[model samples]
Structure formats: C-alpha cells, structure tokens
Target: MALIRKIIKTSSNEHYPFSVPVIENLKELDLEQDIIIFSGENGSGKSTLLEIIALKLNLVRISLDINYSDPEFSDLKAAINAFTVEFSLKPNGFFFRSEDFISYLRYLNKTKVEAEKELKRIETEYREKSAYSKILASMPHKRTLNELDNLYQRNLEEQSHGESYLDFFKSRLRPKNLYLLDEAEVPLSFQNQLTLMVLIKNAVAEGCQFIISTHSPVLMAFPGACIYDFNQEVIKEINYEDIEAVNQLRNFLNDRDRYFKYLFD
Candidate 1:
C-alpha cells in the first residue's frame, strides 16, 4: 500500500461508533485496492465508519467552514483514538460529506453578496472623492471578488444545484490523494452521477485513491473497486451484482408498474 496499510480497533469501550454493531466487531481491514467503497442503506453504518476513518487519517473536510471541535462530534473524536491505523505512507486527502455541500454553497454566495454590497457602498460614498481614495477604498471588496472568481471562474449559484456540486468537486480535486466521500451523488441526477464516476476514474488513474460510502448503484459499479456491504450483519466485501442497491434497482426497472401498484394500493 502506498498509503494506509490497515486499521485496527485496540480498545473495547462501547462508545458511539463502537456501539454500532458492525463497527464494534473486532477486526483489521487490509488495504488492497485504490478505490474502496462502503455500500448500504441509511443507519447501516456506512457513513459513520467512513467518518471515523477520516478522523483517524486527519483529513480536511471537502466542504469548508465546519468546526470539527464542536460538541456534536465529541464522541466521534474520542472514539477514533481507540483505533490504531498502520500507514505505509502519510496519506493526503479530503473527507467530503454530502450533507455539508449545500451549507458550503450558501457560504460562498453569502460572501459574494457581502462584497458586492460593500463595493456598492464605496462607490456611492466615494463619488466626490479623488480617484486614488476611491480605488483604495474599493480595493478590499474587489480583491475578495477576485479570489472568489479564481475558485471556479463562474458563479456557482447561477448553475443548477447538481451543476454547482460537480463544479465544486472539480475545483477542489487534486491528484495523488485519498478521498473519503459520503453519499456524494445525492445532488446529482442519473446522468451527472455517471459524469462523477468518470471524474473518479480519471483521478484514480493519476494515483488518487477513494473510499466512498454510497447507496447509489451506479457508483458501486466502479470496475475493480473493492466494495464492502454494510447491509450485511458483518462488514464483508461483496460483488457488484450482489449489492442490495444494485439488485433492488434492477428489480424496480424490471417491474416499474408492479412497484407503483404496490405503493398506491
């Protein structure tokens, strides 16, 4: 392994993540593939396990402005210390949580709005002042706008939510790092999810590794990626076709009217 080699739980305290059945099980997981995925339904422990791993690795969150030290994460912070992770190399990466994306988007838009308001105020207040004074007064707001523009060169808010999500991911994406993502496909449409898969494939080709926790069957279809089914009683690696999401999707497509009838009745 070029990065983390394994993860082991050294203590037996029934803490938050530890209290979860699948996470509480004693074990070590060896890293073999560059792309690892955790697949399961909600509360099946996929997202929680990924979060603990991200904490162990000390990776930055993809959606910025989150305070990890907040009281809400206190239990997870303590729980992570019980695990000992073996590393072949200190890995670099970001932990992306879908739930945080919208908040991040709002932050960006809010900053831009504030800057615009300041610039407008400066223009009105400095109308009768010397050109140099006006320029100096407006410099800070202009600089803020410039830095925001450099982020994506387009107004993210102007795009559809799905478009903005992809743009944000692309802007933050870098090579030769690991990415831990939880349900990144939430905002994407069926077609956009495939686009995201292509992006992941290209990044992996450039030495990036990913450990994603997702319910999307399209993501689970990544070729040669190692997938663990959290839906199982124990954490177990499984094939694509055998994944519950994949099977359920296939069933729905095969008998769409049948499903609608059952739901309606």
Candidate 2:
C-alpha cells in the first residue's frame, strides 16, 4: 500500500507564528509504518499536535472529547473552526469524546424514525393498489420490515460504551483516509485494545493511516510502531518493552509480593 511517505512539520516548537505550523521536516520521519503511536502525560500537547496534523491532512479526528457538550467541546469547536478558516479543509471527522455517546445514540434512534416513515409510505402504496389487485398480493412486506425495526432497536439497547465506540469506527471510517485518534483506548479493555490494534493494522494495510495519542500499554505495543515520548521531549523508535508503563507493570508483576508487603506488613 502507498504510505504517507512523509509528514513535515514547519515548527516543532510551539512558539512558531502558527499555533501549529505547517509540516517542514518531512525527511526526518518514516511514513511507511503501519501505525504511529504518540505517548505523553496529560497536557503534553499530544492532542493538539494530532489536531494540527488532522487539519493538514483533511482527515477525520476522533477523540474522547466528541461525546461532551461542555467547555472542552466549545474549545475544540473553536479550534476546529479556526483551523478550517485558516485552511481550506472539509469537515470529514467525527469527535466521540466520552460525553458524545448520548449524541450518537440519538443519531442511531433516527433510523427508527426513518423506518417508520418508510413503513407508512409502503402502507399507503399498498392501500392505493389494493383496489386494482388481489388483497393477498397487496398484503405488503410488513413482517420483514418489523423485524428490521426490532433489530435496530435491539442494537440501540445493546450499545455499550465500548460497542458504541467500535460502531462509530466501523461506520465512519472509510478506505484511503486519515484518522486522528486521541486515547482511543478509553472505551476498550486490554483485550479490546489488542483487537483495535489488529483492526488498525488491517486498515493501514488497506491504505488508511492513523495518528493515535494513547497511554494504553497494549496499544503502544503495536508491532513496528513509532513512538514519541512527550515526557522525555524526544521521538525515538522503541518497543513496548521500553515504555515506562510496560516496565512498571512488569516490575510489579515480577515482584508483586515484595511490593505489596511494604503496605500490608
């Protein structure tokens, strides 16, 4: 598959004229990897960087902020508005922050409204044609239609937060596009994070590119991923075993009794 080849950033320092400037250092980074992981502590500008890249690439950006209608949403909306005004880019992304799940459920409910409208339309047509044909012939496909409606309702009922997150990805992501995901592991467990990694690999193989900001050790462990550590202020190629979280986890697991004895004893 054809890769991004390069992402040149005009300013690595935030002090540049633009809040986030254009890409300038394309020669320094590799663009052929299946996944790119951004690791950082809170307030490390990881999300900001991802947003800037999303604007530049005209890709859909998904993050935990998509579900909320609070001050964060307003701030993000302002940034998106500013970015769109500054750059001629179309709105192709969906924001699914934690609070945004309610909005998604509302959207799914619209399918029920649409299905009802279709049922009404079909009933009217059937009644209108009943006079010209056998009543049996104009009985209409109500059973199948009702079954579909029930199926959609069941889906809405079964939409756990994780499932909803996955649903959004499955429905909104298209081939040959860019995806900026911030802490996508928020709704996924360790096992699900691994599943998501596989999906990301498959997507990358199919010509989709992703820039993800996350703290999940499982996600950070994606094979052949490029990791940037905001805490260290360095972009280095490292395996998951080298990540602080993984090392911490390993240390605790290796000497659980010793570590627990300090508190318990």
Candidate 3:
C-alpha cells in the first residue's frame, strides 16, 4: 500500500475568524511513510490535526478523546462525516482513547461470544446431517476455530497493561488500513517499547500505516520517521537522535553528577 500522498485542509470559519479567509496550508503536508510520528506538548493541536487527517483519509482514529465531545472536535467530526459520505470507505474504523480500552475489551469479548455461537451453530448443522462425514469434512476448519478460541482466551488472560495493548493491536489490525494511535505507549515500558516498535515495523511491512502521537523517546527513535516539533512550531524531517526529548534524556543520563549537584546546590 502506498503512503498518504497529501492532506489538504481547506479554509473554514470553524477554528479561525471568517475574515481570515480560507487557507489550505494545513492540508499541504505530505506524510508518505510507513510510520508518521506527531509530537507536541499537550493542547498543541496535535490531536486535532490527527483527527482531521484520519477523517480525510477514512483511516481509523484511536485516541483518548474518542468518547468526549468537545468544541475542539467539531471540525474533525464534520470533516470525517463529510468524507465518509463522499467516499465509499468502510466505517469500521475506530478512534480509541486511553480510557476507552476497557470498553473496547468488553466489546471484543462480546464479539468473541457471538463468533462462538456461530461456530457452534455451524457444527451442529453439520453433525445433524451426518456425524462422521461432516466431522471429517470440517476437521481442519474446526481446528482453526479452536485455535482462535484458545488465542482469544490467552489474550483475555494477559493482565499486564502493556501486554493487553499489544494483544489488542495484534487482534484488531488489518492490512491496508490506517491506524491513528495517540499515546499508544502509555502502558509500555522501555523494553516493551522496543517490542512494540518491532511489531509496528512488521505491521507496516504488511500493508498497514500508522500515525502515532507519543512522548516515548523509544518510539520517537523509529528510524526514518518524520518529526514535527509542536513545541517549536516547526516541522522537519529528523532522526531520533535529534529529538529534544531524547537529547535531554541522554544528557541527563550521561552527567548525573552535574545534574544532581545543581539540584542540591
């Protein structure tokens, strides 16, 4: 799958004054990559921008603000609704915020139950026809279903927050789909961040694209990612080494004595 070639944000009085006129500068950004990182301080319009882009592209938008409706989301919702009506993109995409995970897990569990009912119905139909013949014919498929059920159970048993998030990702991701993740590393530790990175890389290779907003230095370090510095109101393509967060972290670790002395002094 090709990367998103362009994002065009036409001018609207939604956020700005009517007299300011319509500007398309926001839509002019070109994000064509396997993974695009959106970095900014809180309330820097990062989430809003992601919402707009996800709506425009008909990609799944997952963040902490999925349920809460606010004036900030007005433009985003309008844009998404308009795009969905105009295009034939599937509405199966979703936007999940941090707190939404619990609800999401509950929804998935309900879906698994439904799937199990379907599987049972199919099996019963086959058994009533000819027990041995239908069983023999469905042996392979039955095994697959059983495997899926086992996997689902194992996933449900994972109690670690990070593992649960990873499980959700593994189970929900589909090929050629757009996934917008906000603070996806919240539950992950440093080591798990590396594992998640590998998973993201693999997913990208499998025709999935990601737009993520995170503060994790480990995630920001993804090779060849475009870094937009909302703190500085500047956008540039840079390696992870150049990120301010990473640099500051490295500096502190490299000279703990100096930092501690300054603090004590």
What is the lDDT of every predicted structure here? 0.84, 0.58, 0.63
| Candidate 3 residue lDDT tens string, 80-189 | 53222222243234444455676666665666666667667767777658677766766665566576666553565346777787776777766766677777778788
Instruction: State candidate 3's TM-score.
Output: 0.69
The estimated TM-scores of all candidates read: 0.90, 0.63, 0.69
Over 4 Å off in model 2, which ranges? 1-3, 11-32, 61-102, 110-157, 262-265
Better of 1 and 2 by TM-score: 1
lDDT: which is higher, 1 or 2? 1
Per-residue lDDT tens digits for candidate 1, residues 1-265, read 2356677888867667777778888487766578888888899888887877888989998666667687547888888878887876778889989888888889888999999999999999999999999999999999999999998957888898789888888887788888888998899999999999989888888888888888888888888889888876689889998987798889999999999999998
**What residue pairs clash in candidate 3, if any at all?**
7-27, 8-27, 9-27, 61-95, 62-96, 63-96, 63-97, 64-97, 64-98
Off-target runs (Cα >4 Å) in candidate 3 are: 14-27, 60-69, 79-96, 106-158
Clashes of each: 0, 16, 9
| lDDT (tens digit, per residue) of candidate 2 on 44-104 | 6566656555655555433223444665444544444233222222324443334445565
